[model samples]
Target: MSDNRRIAEEIIKAVGGKENISSIAHCATRLRIMVEDKENINQPAIEEIDKVKGAFYNSGQYQVILGTGTVNRIYEEVEKLGIEGMSKSDQSKEAAKNGNLLQRSIRSLGDVFVPIIPVLVATGLFMGLRGLVMQEQILALFGLTLADISDNFILFTQILTDTAFIFLPALVAWSAFRVFGGTPIIGLVLGLMLVSPSLPNAWGAAVGDVEPINFFGFIPVVGYQGSVLPAFIAGIIGAKLERQIRKRVPEALDLIVTPFLTLLVMSFLSLFIIGPLFKSVEEYILQGTLFVLGLPLGLGGLLIGFFHQIIVITGVHQIFNLLEIQLLDKFGNNPFNAIITAAIAAQGGAALAVGVKTKSKKLKALALPSSLSAFLGITEPAIFGVNLRYGKPFLMGLIGGAVGGFTASLLGLKATGMAITVIPGTLLYLNGQILPYLLVNMIAIGVAFTLTWLFGYSDKEKKM
Candidate 1:
């Protein structure tokens, strides 16, 4: 048998064979497979396979890191093994059926947020850049003050930094429609209409800066800028309404009638009913989450820091996107980002310890890359493939994360925005708090690394 075939066979066997896998896909560096039974998979044997970087179960998927081109080659080989292939859409649909309530919720949230993270990440980088340029220290290096920057340049930065949050409702709407089996373009248009310039902006209405237009003296409708729940709820409603309308409308009038009713009914309902109701609901949730973050003496930070990755494992961490967005919109900065970064840095630290201490060359190669990926802001590889695989290391990383979170809270460090972390996260702290951010990261990494190396793995396991 060819070497590639052997590797493919090992992957197939490790993941509980052909009957157990529902779907498989590959990204840049990992093979993502949804297995029918996670418990049936043999993890250690998979890790022992030559050229297999690492293996871990996360977010209801069995992800195997094989590194770049090597992953593609093995994926092709797996395809030839006569296992039925499936698309990501299939996996998503299957997600609802395969797991418990928490898993399904996390998977659904992940489905909605993962598509949007790229745009958010890009915008967050710019927010960081804008802060960097506005910092007094950095301004000294440029021999300028905030006033020294031209009006046009400042306007451009404002537009760049603000555009994403302002239109976030549209993105969420578009994504939610895709997830729920609706026509995506219509959802995009629906999102656009939600934030139409003619309506009062959501934030302005909340703070009493803009009054909502009376809809026949009964309803107060506003644009949903910087909002998540309203758009998400609206999207679900719109998608289901569109699908149902399409089924009942005559074939000839289907396009016109279906869209017309979908928009007229759903958009009005969203504006008059769902949007306002959910907005009130989100306000309460926002208050609750902020209450947690505001607990005295860093207690909030310690709890969140220690448990964020545990939430990540369950795929429910994306739920925090709502609270993070709320904080950013209202307060102009996010301390929550600072706390979460600590958790991520600790995961990286723990992963690095495994890489350095492992006697297996394959694990050594895998650990370092995964650790670097975590440091650069993606923690799946580190959290699943390394830290969590070694149970002690995972807990150690959480301890380090808790310490780092406490440190951040005590120092009152906060990020200029949300969604960026670790090295990319550094950009968010450029407003004179960069030193504190770096220090928190060092403490997280150092503590996690020391504890994980000392306690996470034994010499025998390292040799294995």
Candidate 2:
């Protein structure tokens, strides 16, 4: 057998063979398998597998950290072994179907956000690049001003950069439909209707540069171009409405009538009711977040730093994603981005210390790569696979993050972008403010490292 098959077989055996697995899924860096019994898992054996970095249980899955670019192959091998695989959405749906209300809500929330993270990551990179190209020094090196750039090229870059936020409703609607067990194409059409070019753009509306159109000559209406909550609520309405329609419509005419009715009904309700209601809610949330973060003496950063990773562990950190975007939209910068960066770096620091302090080859292999990944802005491997697996290291990382966050908050460190952190995060600070950003991160890393090295691990916990 090829190596991947062998590894897949070994994984199955270690997790109590094929019989014990209830379902399987994979994300960017881990194999998330649900098992019938945790007691049947051979943790030591799984840890010994070549190329398997580490294993841990979280969010009800037996997750094996496989690093970026490597997880897909293992997931495929596992699939070929005749075990059915599920999408993250499907997995969330199955697990949350019978869960408590809170569990279902959290799963639904994750469904709306996790699938879109890659786009946000790309947006963060663009923000970084935009900062670099527009800097006075960088422009001087190129013998140009911000205005010296060609207007057509500038518009092209603007389109490329803002398209995601411009029609963000469409993406959310599409994902949310699938999550809620409805036809996704209908969701796509509804999303497009919400952000049609005929309507005023969200940014223009925000700046009062465009007037709202009166719907049916009475209620005011505007496009939901950059709105999340509106699209999310609309998706729920559309999905439920479509499901109900599908039940009554004949299959012969189902394809023809169902989508038409779903879109026609949702568009009117969204433009007049749900969209307006949710937009107001989002505004209140934005104001509340701003007030909290603007508190004196860095309290916001300190608390967020100490607990952000815990939020990540529970998969609810995406709510802050909405806050970050709103902060960037209403203001010009995101202070929360830098604070979150410190939080992630602390986890990396703790993991690095664990790697250095460990005697076992398995723990060494797990911690080192995970720490490196954390520095690059992906912390699941380090957080779930390492620091969180050993509870003390997780707490130590939190302390380090709290200190770093407090420092950044006190210094009023801000980023030109959102959603990227750690190494790639440096890109967000390239505009004449690189030094202080670097200093803030360094302090965070140093504190976390010192604390982790001092208290996060011991030889006794190194058995893998």
Candidate 3:
């Protein structure tokens, strides 16, 4: 048998045979495998493979890491085994059953961005703390005034945050290409054009006051920067194009000619067809959100506020970026800022509940600091370990979040900037109605705390 076929068979056997795998996909450096029985797969044997780095499971996916370029090749080989229709629980029927609403929501959240969240959170926290330091003149001892420090910090933070968005096309291209078993460099080049700063400026200026840019005598092309879906579509197209090009190009000129043709065609399609189509959809979604938020503050705020924690738990809360970005760009402020404050408060409430209810000193120690961290908008530890474990605390937090959100909306509180660290940052929103916002926040926390205490602990029941 051929070497590629042999490799595929080896992988199939290592993963508990072709019967054990339900489905498979690949990421930048890992094979995302869905197995019928996770226990059936021999992780150590898989890791021992020359191309494999390690293996682990998260978000209901069995992941096998393979250094750099191996993922694409392995993914391609696996696809030929005709295992595409296998269910995630085909091997172990019990595994495929759905979890509860909260469990499913949390799992979905982790699945969507768990691979990318560490960098996103770290970058966010860095920006928030950096702003505080500059605002407080904490770096003045280094001969830097507040203005100077702020400028420098803002520049650095912008670069870091923007990198992910700006080069998002490239990241998606690389990941998708590897997943589909194609040359990533060709996909990367195609992605680069979509995010190219010069292209957006040029396109924007060209279409100024007339209409959006048109491509190839008919198709409309939109400028893509900091967009998610368009780049993903483009990457998929680019990978397919690369596969075709590789087959047709001569061995001697394949390196140079294949990439050139793939990039040229993919870039054209991305800019002219894919990018503009997605942009229009994004604009429509934003308009829909505005209409929804325009409802009466009591119902609108309560619903939005109540579901906000649920959204965060699902990790699709980043969808809120559309509202925040639009408001920031047009109005220089956003009212949705109060929603985030409530989210932080909910985590704090839940953590406090866990701390008070748990009898184990070790658990209390962990919960205490976790509560403080949640108060500062760092809620993973509390959410994953405490609130989730104790269940009632999380529900109480949502109730608190809804009440707080409603009060803030009623007061028409607006945030001047996006700051994860809330207590001190709340001052930034203190234009005229400072007291109302403060009162709203305090009330929200109080409600959350009371609910947590009541639901999380029973006077008649012994503490754990």
- Specify the highest-TM-score model's number: 2
Task: Compute each candidate's TM-score over C-alphas.
Answer: 0.90, 0.92, 0.60
Q: Model 1 over residues 370-402: C-alpha lDDT tens digits?
A: 888889877877876667666888999999999
Error of 3 at 198 (Å): 5.9
* Per-residue error (Å), model 1, residue 168: 1.2
Models sorted by TM-score, best on top: 2, 1, 3
Alpha carbon lDDT at 93, candidate 2: 71
Q: Which residue pairs collide in model 2, if any? A: none
Each model's lDDT: 0.84, 0.84, 0.63
Clashes of each: 0, 0, 3
lDDT of 2 by residue, 1-464 (tens): 98988999899999998899999998878888988888999998987887787787655778888888788998999999998899877886776654467656767877787777678667666766787787788889978887788889778768767878877889889888888988988888888889999997777877899988887787778888778888899998899999999999999999899998998899988889998899999999998988878888999889888999998877667678778877765675789988889999988989999998888777888789888999988888888778877888889889888988988899898887777788878877876668888877787788888888887788875566
Clash list (residue pairs), candidate 1: none
* Superposed Cα deviation of residue 311, candidate 1 (Å): 1.5
The CA lDDT at 299 in model 2 is 94
